[model samples]
Target: MARLELKSVRKSFGSTAVIHGIDLVVEDGSFTVFVGPSGCGKSTLLRMIAGLEEVSSGEVHLDGIRCDHLLPSARGMAMVFQSYALYPHMNIHENLRFGLVCQKTPKAEIEPRIQRAAEILQISHLLDRKPSQLSGGQSQRVAIGRAIVKQPKAFLFDEPLSNLDAELRVKMRGEIVALHQRLKATMVYVTHDQVEAMTMADTIVVLRNGRIEQVGSPAELYARPVNQFVAGFLGSPQMNMLAGLGLQSSEDRFSVSADGGRLRLQLARRAEATTGDLRCTLGIRPEHLALSERGALRVTVTGREFLGSETIVSGTLQSGESIRASLRGAVEVALGESVAFEMDLDHLHVFDQDGAALDEVDNALPVDSRQDEVRQASPHHR
Candidate 1:
């Protein structure tokens, strides 16, 4: 496996600049995922790494060797695309061997590589099957197998699971993670789905408007985002952002008036640089909110979605700001009912009008133990 680095990477179409100057490193044998919404340049950045797209201005390095000038075939990287991209007329075995054949590999050396790939992908039984005769998941396995046979220094995946059904997607995600572990090869994956990035990546790169917003492990980005956009973009149901007026700090406590002073929250003194009045935003995740009799915020129930094990309730604050809460079980709240909600104070986030995260509270909030469990279970975790 090889380490990949991008230094001041940039891209543009004429005068319209896309990827800004971006600097990042993909550690050897690590699974790095590039994630963002559409038009955010995630796909463009991945293509640049694979030599599928030219870099406007930057250096692409593999194991400390500059390779931006290399052709796609000379990069020693195997790419797996979203579309299966299998040759329709070729059987699975022939499809897996096509690349090696084109390279003029010794005939004796090629069959063993193809056989090993098919066996590892568990598609040995389907060696003779054509692309049209296989299921979507099977076809994807063959596509991945094709990459495996190449024995490249790294693998690049461009939303390889996006075309599968929900259940199949989940199944394929596990398979890919397992494949990464078994191979211990560096992989770069591109997807717009945060869930995919969260579950599969050792390191996640959050991009916006062609610039890198944040780069961290799933837990780091989730528990402590560097900005409002990073906070809102990584979570499901999204974080609730309420416009607030930061009040003066009193000793070790700080206060903020949100929802036009109808809601007030006291926080542990954090941002020592800002002691006086400031305009800011209060952020709390849905799962970190709960219904309570002595809650400081009042919300009027709007709707509820019961999803077997948990209930997602949407509401509006006194100032008409929308809010959502994820409760443990079925919640019995009627429409238009006013309810008081409490937040997990330690987990709250504060962002200035500029959207940058303020200095964290002294002593800091403890990382959630559940997050540790996830990392421990991930195959990519060192």
Candidate 2:
């Protein structure tokens, strides 16, 4: 395994700066994921680490050795690309052995390495099959197997499952995670999918506009985002954002009137950031809103999607702001009917006008505890 570090790493293409100064460390044997929207420089950062792209400034270190100046082949890392770059003419075994052969590995040693990799990946029976004869999943496994046979210090995956269908993507996610656990190797993965980053990473590095936004475990980022951008980006169905103006305050709580005074909220004051009447954004996730007749927020149901295990209801608040609620089980609500849903006070996220989180969470909510449990049970857990 290897410990990788980037010290004020930067990248620029002519006059356009793509990667800002980024200082990060990938702990030895940890699964680290770099995730963000497109053009966020995640792939560029990964390529820099792999020596496929040069750093404009700063240094890259591997196991305390400066490697930014080294060639990719000399960096002791294996990379699996989004497109499985297997040779069409080569069989599975030949593809797996290609790298070792190029390095002038002994003839006796190459066959043993190939055999071990194929067996571990459960592709021993398909070793004689050409790349064109295999399914997408099978081809991906061969690509990974090629990397595994190298036995490098660390592995790098650049959206390795992007080409698969939805169901296959889900299945391949589990397989790769299992592979990480079995090998216990250091890995750096780049993806635009937050779900993949949340599920697979021991540490998730969130980037925005070529700059680092937040770096933490999935649970930490989910339960306590540092800013509105991070909060809105990580969750599925996204958090519902409401423009509100603070009206009153107390020693440990405050009241905010949202939706042109149609919706009122009395939230616990976790920080001393907001004092007077200030305009801010109130964020509530879909799952945190429950259907209640006596709820404070009134909404008109616009649409409903019954997802078997849960129901996702889309509605418009009295202020004309669109909101969604994820209610448990099947909920039969008529369209255009006015419904009220209560927000889970403990799970609320408040952001300042500048999109910065204003709360320093003290009281732990049930959902937060559940996220903690998930983090603890994760195979990537430290």
Candidate 3:
């Protein structure tokens, strides 16, 4: 295992910069995921580290050695690409041994390496089969086995499961995680899928336009995003954003008012930011809202989607903003019927004028207080 580091790394295409100066450290034996939308420079960054792309103006180091100028093979890394990149005419055993053979490794050493990798990946029985003869998952295992035979310092995966069906993707994800635990190998994976990043990464590096947005554990990024972009980008079904103006402010609390409702929020501990009459965005995850007998906001249901264990209701708020709420139980509300909904104050998120998150939003209020405030202030309750 080896620690990987990028210091002030950058890339450009002529006058247009693709990757801004960025720094990151992937700890020894840790699974680090670089995730972002396309054109965000994630794959480009990965290629640079693999020595497939030249560094425009930065340093890449592996185990304390400057390796940016080294060849891909000399850098001691193995890469598994999205396409599998298999030799169609070669059997699984030959494919797995090809790299070692090309390096003129002794013939006596090649067979054992291939057999060991095949067993580890559970593809030993299919060693005689060609790439065209294997299933998608089986082919992926062969590709991974090929990397394993190299026994490099680190594994670099570029969307290695993007071609599989949803079920196979889930199965492969677990298998990969298991493989990591068994080998304890350092890994750097690149993907555009947030789900893949969330599920597999020990540390996630969220990227935007070739720049780092945030780096944290899955829970940290999901529960406390540093900006609106991170919050909106990381969640499924996305976060619901509402516009309102701050009405009251105090050291520990604040209130905001919209067209037909108001919200009271507790500030995060040590939160000393200014508050008063400022236009801010209110962010709430779909699962953080619920139907209530009394709430400051009322919405008319427009649609509903049943997602097995939960139901998602789409509606227009009194202010005409569309929002989605996830309910644990079945929802049978008719279209156009008004339903009262309450926000869980402890689960609320606030964003500044420029969409940056304020550091002092509190989420420690008692659940009873939150429900009480909604019940007491709502017109429907009175």
Candidate 4:
């Protein structure tokens, strides 16, 4: 395992700069993920690290050694791409050993390495099959096995699961997590999928337009996003942002009064500095809204979607803003029926006019109590 660092790394094609000055420190044996929307330059940065692309400026270091000038094979890293890139004519065993053979490793050493990787990936039985005869998942395992044979200092994956079906993607995700645990090697994974980043990464680096947005653990990014973009991108169903009037006070609480409706919210203490009748936005996750007999704002249900264990309820607030809430299970609330829902104030997220999060707040309830409520409310599961 080795530590990786990029200092003010940059890349540009002609006069058009894709990656701006970027500085990042990837700890030893850490599984770091670079995630963002398409055209965010995440893959460009990854390729720069792998020496597939030249750095416009700054340095790339591996294990404290400057390696920006080294060749891709000389950088002590193995990369698995989205395409699998398996040799169609070769059997799995030969494909896995091909890299080692090119490096002129001993015949005795190659077999042991191939066997061990096959055992780890549970593809020993598929050794005689060609890429043409294997399923997508099996082909992916062969590609990973090829990387394993190199025994490089770190592994790089570029959207390695994007080609698989949904079920296979989920299964392969678990396998990758388990593979990391077993190897404890430094791995850098790049993907546009927030779900993949959240599930697999020890630390997630969110990027936008060639610049790093935020880097944190999955839970940290989910619970305390730095900006509206990160907040909206990281969560399923996204976050609900309702435009409201801003109020400044030391009490750490604010209320939104719009269209003859008012909703009071407890904001983080850092928001106290913001003043004036500024146009602010209130951000709340779907899970934070709940049915309540006596609530502040009123909305009429517009749609309900049942998804087995959970239901997504869509409604329009009096101000004509659409809101979605993830209820535990199927709900009987009729469309166009007026319903009142309460917000968990402590769980509320506040953003400035620029969409930056104000501060972090601890608003999680005990897990056991939450599970109890879900069990009691969702009759289909029981």
Residue 36 of model 2 has an lDDT of 98
lDDT of 4 by residue, 1-382 (tens): 4999999999999999999999999999999999999999999999999999999999999988999999998899999999999998899998998899898889889999999999999999999998999999999999999999888899999999999999999999999999999999999999999999999999999999999999999999998899989999998888998886654444554434332334544344555435445566778898888876555446788998888878888989878898988888767777887776667767677677888877665442222322222212211222
- lDDT at residue 186 of model 2 (Cα atoms): 95
- Report the lDDT tens digits of candidate 1 across residue range 58-114: 999997788899999999899999999999999988898899999788999899999
| Cα TM-score per model | 0.93, 0.93, 0.92, 0.91
Query: What is the C-alpha local distance difference test score of candidate 4?
Result: 0.84
Q: Which 10-residue window of candidate 2 scores lowest in summed lDDT?
A: 373-382
276-321, model 2: which lDDT tens digit per residue? Answer: 7878988889999987655667788899998988888899977899
Candidate scoring better on TM-score of 2 and 4: 2
In model 4, what is the error at residue 87, expressed in angstroms? 0.8
Cα displacement (angstroms), candidate 4, residue 341, comes to 1.1
Flag clash pairs in model 2: none
- Model 3: what TM-score? 0.92
